[model samples]
Target: MTREKSQSIASQKLQQKVKGPVAQELKEMVPNRKSHQREPRSKDAASNSPVQASVQSIITQIQNGKPNVSGSKETPEDLSFVMSSIFPKETGSVDTSNLKMKPLDYERPDVPRLSFGLERVLFNPGVYHLRDPRSRVYNFDPYLGAIMPVSEFDFDALKAYITSSKDETLAGIARAEKKKYIGSSSSMTSVLSHFHYLLSNWRGVDTRMMSQNFPDHMRSFTRLLRSPAAMFLRYQNGSYAIDADKEFDSANILMNLGKSMEKLLTLPKEDFERYRRTHENKISAEEEQAIPEAYHYSTMGDFLMRSQLDAYDPRLPGTGMFDLKTRAVVSIRMDARNFEHGLGYEIRHVQGGYESYEREYYDMIRAAFLKYSLQVRIGRMDGIFVAFHNIERIFGFQYVSLPEMDQALHGQTDTSLGDAEFRLSIGLWNKILDKVTAKFPKRSIRLHFETRDAQTPFMYIFAEPVTNDEIEYIQTKNQAEIDAYQRRILNLEPKDGNDDLDETPASPEKPAANSQPTAEQNAQPDAQAAYDSSAPPDESFLAELEAEEADLFKGKEIMAMTLVVKNLVNGSPVDRPMVFRADDKWTVEYELSELQGKQVSRLYNACQTRREKALSGRGEDEADAASNVYIRRLRDLAMKGRAYRAKQDDFDSKHGTVVLDEDV
Candidate 1:
């Protein structure tokens, strides 16, 4: 949902319902921790102080949770500590026969409960069925090609869905491309990556820097920890988020089958036959709109979840919210170049038929089902509706209900084990929230998790203060603010009797008094094919990125384009039009601030998109050449802002949000 729409919701009751600490602003919920300061102390005093002692005690408790193996014990999550359990096996799959669990004993609890107590479901989570990728970029507004209308899903709604067929019939229907979405939701990876720890690691193992059970879990961690600048980049400048291009990710044909099958099953056989004939007759190049994505945001005890649903059918068994899964028959080949990230794959669109992948189905199940089943039970979906297909064509489909997954994962299909896991998961989240908040309060932090074989898993976390580079940038911003304040105070001062009125006429380049720049200052040069007329960005957009009330973007999604404008080419010749010329690089990188970074990137990409079309020599494509002229006009404006920055006569600082590190 777009921030404009969220701010547009006129219903006071709906607004009030979602207002509170439990469903608080995303940033406030898991806050940033500032670096610490300490007074000098004797060795004994330092070791024995309450603050030091408690910190150590807390770490120990988080690493080694409550006892669970004796005659009587509790298997509670690390209270107050958020942990990502690492499975020591390849593929994160484990025999469910090893799980050992018990009902939690809160009477002897050692951690904090939620501030408002606990509940299974949260307030209205505005669910929008995502019909297209463009919708994600723009608002779920009606003017665009939005499939689902944006609105709050009342308590009665928010179930789930999936579609599976029993045969190869979907193959000849003509294939279409599925866009990048598997890693689209970072929240999904954050919330669901710890299943191996919950379901199979009966004994919490220290898993830091060890072999991981699933590739994506480790990959997410690596990307998040790449650099200090990257840690908060999503919040600071995320208009576009680039996802890992993975194998088995963009199976367009399979995605089509999953989206279409459930609804097709509703049609009569005669209608189906006619529809099939039309579908198979000839495939069009245009892609079908993505089905509406149903979001069910609910709270389970300490857990706050937003289940993204594919479809919902009450007629189907169990909650009827079947998770949609598209299983490709091809084997994965890991890209090991970036070793810090355990395993990732190159982006390749596979083209193959039934015989090519049939023999690989059993192995695919072994590699994927554990992760799949864990998602099913955790989200509490009815089950998973998996559509089987090779990249080229559909093979068959199957619906594995929760009971079936339970039976496969555990020895029984009864809800007993699934119930235990669910309660346990929520309890873990509750404990994590309490402990982490207590330890860091409102601070930015980095967490490192490790689970030793048969040993307790530990999370090592630390706070992040503003970086020196960021500090330097802000200081420059600060100086500009000071200059602006001085100018305002001077202008407001009682002027000498005959001072300003008789002064020489102001130059066209400098406005009279404290006033807006004249048309001459606004009309910048460098009116090449890649620049725009508008110059510097307003300072307010990049300063103090926080708001009193929170929504999805947390009040700072002013930029939505993630592409850097320097990577649009295909092979070696690929480098030709994709990148800016060498001289244009330095001005963009060192001269402009992050806000201008967004503007120039947008300006340059627009120029290239036009250039690429024109270069193709298509007759109608010359329109791109005209648009390039205006785009360059904007680019030049951004560059001029850097030169004029010393005017130092604009903007308020909003009391700069940066916290000074004690060590610095």
Candidate 2:
């Protein structure tokens, strides 16, 4: 048999022999490593025991596809459990008296701080408000159709409610995963925002956790060395760039599941924006209202920080805000995406479930707390409520305060505030970032981050060149600035110095009504609108998907299509290309009411031409997005883009194109 086939079979047998949550970590590994090369073994490298040798034997068999294997049916008990499981899970509330203590008050190095009384420095604002500089990126209203008061937090009730809808939620997530939720998918709305965490982790890697925080400052890289090494990346667009390698993201699944749980666990109090929406949108006020947006923004130096609160619990003292988290019982392995029948992918009861039967305290400390702590502190929230589940059932829920999380990660030798160590890490990370940027400003670069089991403290970072895009991936305050840089660097005039779609302005028409329209009517703009990145897709066009795309989509259930259309205009245009369902066809909303009919006809003709061109230009490889499934999201987007182009063309045609500071 081939080496790859042998490796797959051997790995499968080994995982099958393991039970409980021990196999969870085995599912996700660092990419491109011979093993967990990203985290080198500093402590156990010199020691060799039977357990180590036996595990090595298994690895060797898998790697070389040897004739005999440790995990073969003849030697089933060759290895009892992965060594990490020695701690075992004795579930229930964990005792924390042994953990070190420190006061919660500390100033955030990034945000402005306020001091109260003698030493209490509140780094996170009691209330959050800051200018958001991103466009194309969209905001969404929170879902409040089933929020309950914080005082009424009944684990049993939550378990009952969530468990009932578990199947539907998992199924929805499965379908979403299958579709890979591209283009205008709600998952894409705050896409850049999600990268901050991973970025911080990359920056914060040092020896306080291993001294002045250098590679050789003091000692142990043990903790970081023990971390899962599967995360790898390539940077782009002034932020952590997206990669196709991250096709099946468990983190996203957790985020979605967590959001659903938050809606269920939250208090029904209407947020300020939702109250405003009720007053403004007459239809929304008269009908079921769209929930207000739920997120807080703050700036730390030149970087942007956004904290998405899961829920606000007044019942909790102080900040009262708390995050809801879903800890999956186990990660679904690549070989078996059988989410439906998988042993660990289902939901359970709050009382006697998988959690009760397993030990999670050490697991929480070693595996989850740092990230959980970072998130809690980012919002300066009171704490987090965690739901442990095996997907088939609900195990239970537990709350860990910021202080508790701090103690677990930092321990009792209090430095300056409980967050002193973290602050230092941030400073050092920034320094490293500054050096890198200084060396390669305004250029696209590849960062090869990985661990090497071949050496001690296996972390390695390789900086190399990549074919540059128009815009740099360095830090910027907002999307507009990023756009500005692109405009300055890129020539609008085509290679032959001729304008293909020369930008111009059409004759001015009467202004659109100042009154707001329904969410469906004007998805993104009050004047020239486009589809909100977060707007519910116009899936009424799904029938066209089956007809125009592929036979595989024939008779399949209606699902979200994965097509993305970029913003076509760059200057003084507030009415972006928002996609909306207008009668039988999707149209961009024209904020200028008097011009809607003419605008619609022009865009319709433009879109038709673009669609024909896009269809004719398709290639075999780029055609199927989901399995053998094909979609017109690309063609539809091209049509939408052409419609946008027509808008720009009308303008340039009426008023000859001019290049000015703001004329992009």
Candidate 3:
């Protein structure tokens, strides 16, 4: 096929795929139904009908060579794209067997006594009462029999009752059992089926009763059996209540109750036995003696259990004690702001306005402790133990220094103490200390001071023994402050010296202030005396120097001087043999020479005149031109003398220079 035809066929196939079987079905279903319907359709229905029409139009456009009717430009589907679209690997399948299968080797143990004192009082009150009634007086009601012992008794009987009522409970049990297996299914269909079965079969009363009555031994097992099914059902239906009107089947409930008892059963029997042994003798003695008005009964089992969980040491090997944290509200306050007094007034106002019941409780306890101890070492003492009853979350006890605690307690809201932030702060402190040490290498006895957050009642304070480097840095900072202050002072000071000079008097009587003496008076005294004592020359010396200067320019021509030189040399000449005077240094005169030597004499005279004028600060340009002309005449004579010799050398020696050979 031709390329165009091939492309067209591919486009047709793409249009068919993009249109999709679902879309075609929707179109076919709607078109005939719409024709038969005489009733007016809602806006939503009417709007949906055109969407299929638009898809069809786009399909037609793709089939023909036309603009896409559907606004979107759809690409043709290749085989790889089709495979990926149909069979997405990431979320396509899940191995549910691993998720649903219970751990095979974990056997349910017989329930033991509840070990925690508080938990026993709340969850197993019957055990607490049976063990010691006198310790259970607060808010007590005799009619509402203790829940633990009663539940335990009923739990055993309920199981027996369930085994006997097999026919009545079969449907519920079968459904529950099927739910358990179905919970293991990987397909969405199986999961949905299991969920529906759970909703139809699950009995809330049975579940709740089992949970209430379940001993510690059975708790894990009960949760293991029932939790997944309940969760799956709740997720599907979006609610906990199913079959609200019907009573829960007792058989399945008893089975769940039996399962929950597993946790209590798993507790070490030796621990309970030890408690029983330790307390039996004491109880008997108390009974034999006159009964006291009040008594406190404690158990070794409870004590050991608590100590096992709560005891932690920083030095403990492999404990990872520092990493463990109990979730608790941590209050942080800026003690530095407090120390600054009114400087941070806005922050202070905020701190004053904010209050929490927890803070109040903590404060009360702290005050009571202080009152009892006189001086409490807060850092050494474990702060508090907070327990989350509804959840398994636990918090550890910690205490911070007084100042740190004060800072934390005064200013801010509660925030979690992040391990990362604490570690970062420590690292920063170490780096700062290192830098300080490096800066002051010579200082052996250095003390460093730093500020850090206190954990308990979170606060900040000056931590001490600062290094020499730290002190020097602070000193440098202070010096900068001082320099700035000095500069400001300097700028503010008046410009006294210059201003005073401007205001001074300028009288002639003040020796013509700022003016220099005339040249004759300022001349050296010795030179001046010599000049005064000696009589002036009879003009002969001056005439001789002038004649000598003229002889120097005798051969020079006047017209040879270019217009540039004329303008630069003499603008106008005086017709005179110009005489120049010098003080004991020299003298010169240039006059007309004999008439036969007029040209040479005139040129020489002109040159000398120009020279003398220049020396006496006249005709500067003329003097420069005369000097240049003299130098050029000398250069020309030298060049002419060398030309013949140069030519001879070039011809004979094959070199540039030629020397003239005189008649030797």
Candidate 4:
């Protein structure tokens, strides 16, 4: 058997021994039972079973009185009972002697301090002006309605109502107020009434909970029914009264609406942009603008209103303004084909094709970071670009790390960021503070970038130092191997059919016969000649020459075989080739005579064996260690070449095939 085959068998056996029993056990425990069957137990019953005697002994001890002890010690049973029954109650009582009650003052405090920055501007402008005296102008409503009665609008009561209201609604109102003043209408009144009703009847008929209990289709139908009611409340201006019981029953509808709105708000800006861009191509500009504006006002009005109330001073340096998004990271990804095209493969006028593409990506990121820093006071920043080839794999990245604006100017790669090129670019900004704390003695600023997919070319920037020793080590090893392989490839000499076969001097008669053939003799090809006159007799010639050529020249065929080795970690391929030369003995007398007379068959067999060993993963050096013994055997056999048998049985039983002899 070949060494490779033998090794494979051994490996299989070892793996089977290690994993066979465990696999079998798993299969048995989690057998392919019907879905109705109970789930399998995680532990074995026998292993988990407690000793009956030990349990009885413990029980008996617990039941019996303990030996006398000085200090009090609670028994396990007594402690269990005490813990089970320890419910405490509040008496709602106070000590009259310590409590002092003072007359209430209806007047407001002499000096009012503004806890929130925007309160002065919002209140001073009289933005709360209302048409109805009953409709008070509150900065934000704790309840859905602005018409809470004075009796139910105390500080604690207001807080409880607000706390109980949907968080999304409160947030939406806050956002809306921030953008524009919120006004009351009939729709708002209905919404307030419905919200209060729902809160009152919260115990029963919750449509949201009911939907969760029902199938998907049913839930969807319920949602459709509830959507109009929600929209009416958000947009309609009609007075509508909701029964308290009915409100409680349908509380789930409001909750679901809030959830849906939250989800809509959470969508990424890029996704929104993509949707808007795609739709813009299909619809007229006027229609597109109208739809978004109407949709925003109808659905997001509350949020916009809140935003107006909580506005911050945009003129102040470092103040984050809503419209200013300069410091935010932007990511770019390119497929392999697009990447190549951008590099100037299609437009050959550009010199550094791939490199130019990489540089462009870097420049874009740098420009974005710089712009963001200037506008938004970005302390550190990153930009990322990802390039993809085939979607499945074959992707790489180019990364540029700029630790800070200063570092970027100096053109130095940061060492504190991660070694991953994609991460260093995009996520660097997000991790700047973390990296700074870990690396610098004093606090410092940083930025980072990261790419999501591995199957694309990517570029990113980072502003932190990160050690990359592991990456350098891998690169060094690969380079070393590649260099060595190149040297070996270059050193291989081209072989000729008539090269000196041995260093030993030929005898006088042999030397005389070895002289160049006469013109007439050469013109009349000798069938017994070892070298083919028509062939160039070099490696290049041999490469072009097929098995048929060997048969035509040597009156026998040559065999070739290939074996592939792969690196287990990275899945890189390694190729190994084996060649054997053979010919029929009768047609070529000199070749057969030389082989039989010098026992060449044995040497050929030994070489084949060594080739197999090397192909089986044994290093070339290991195979070479046995070369001397094989060569000596071959030398002895080559001397008796003519006496060799013609039958396949003799060749097969002695040596498998011709093998190349290698130096130790």
Using TM-score, give the best candidate's number: 2
Segments of candidate 2 deviating more than 4 angstroms: 1-256, 267-290, 299-302, 314-318, 330-336, 342-358, 392-395, 413-418, 446-459, 464-664
Which regions in candidate 3 have their CA more than 4 angstroms from the true location? 1-15, 18-21, 25-113, 120-664
Candidate 4 lDDT over residue span 237-268, tens digit each: 11111111111011111122222222122233
TM-score of each: 0.31, 0.33, 0.15, 0.13
- Backbone clash tally for model 3? 34
Tens-digit lDDT track of model 1 for 1-664 = 7533432231222223332321232112221223323344465543322223222332333333423332111112221211111111111111122222221211221211111111101111211111112222221221111111111101112223221111111111111111111112223333333423322332221123222322212111121111111112111111111121111111112223333343333333333233332334322222222223344433344333334555455555555566666554331111111111211111111121212222222333333444566556545567665544322223334466666554544435565544454444444433433343344343322221211111222222221222324323322422433333333322434445543311222333422332212222322222221122123223363222112112212322222111011111122111112222222211000000111222322222222222222222211111232245533333343344334432311321332222122222
lDDT of 3 at 322: 13
Steric clashes per prediction: 41, 37, 34, 79
* Tens-digit lDDT track of model 2 for 44-67: 441222223334444553454333
List, residue by residue over 2-68, the lDDT tens digit for candidate 3: 6456545644444344345434433343322224554445544433422232333333333343421
Q: Assess candidate 1 and give its lDDT.
A: 0.28
For residue 7, model 1's alpha carbon misses the true position, in angstroms, by 65
Cα lDDT for residue 601, model 1?
25
TM-score quality measure for candidate 1? 0.31
Kindly report which residue stretches of model 4 are placed more than 4 angstroms away from their true locations once superposed. 1-281, 290-356, 361-369, 372-406, 410-664
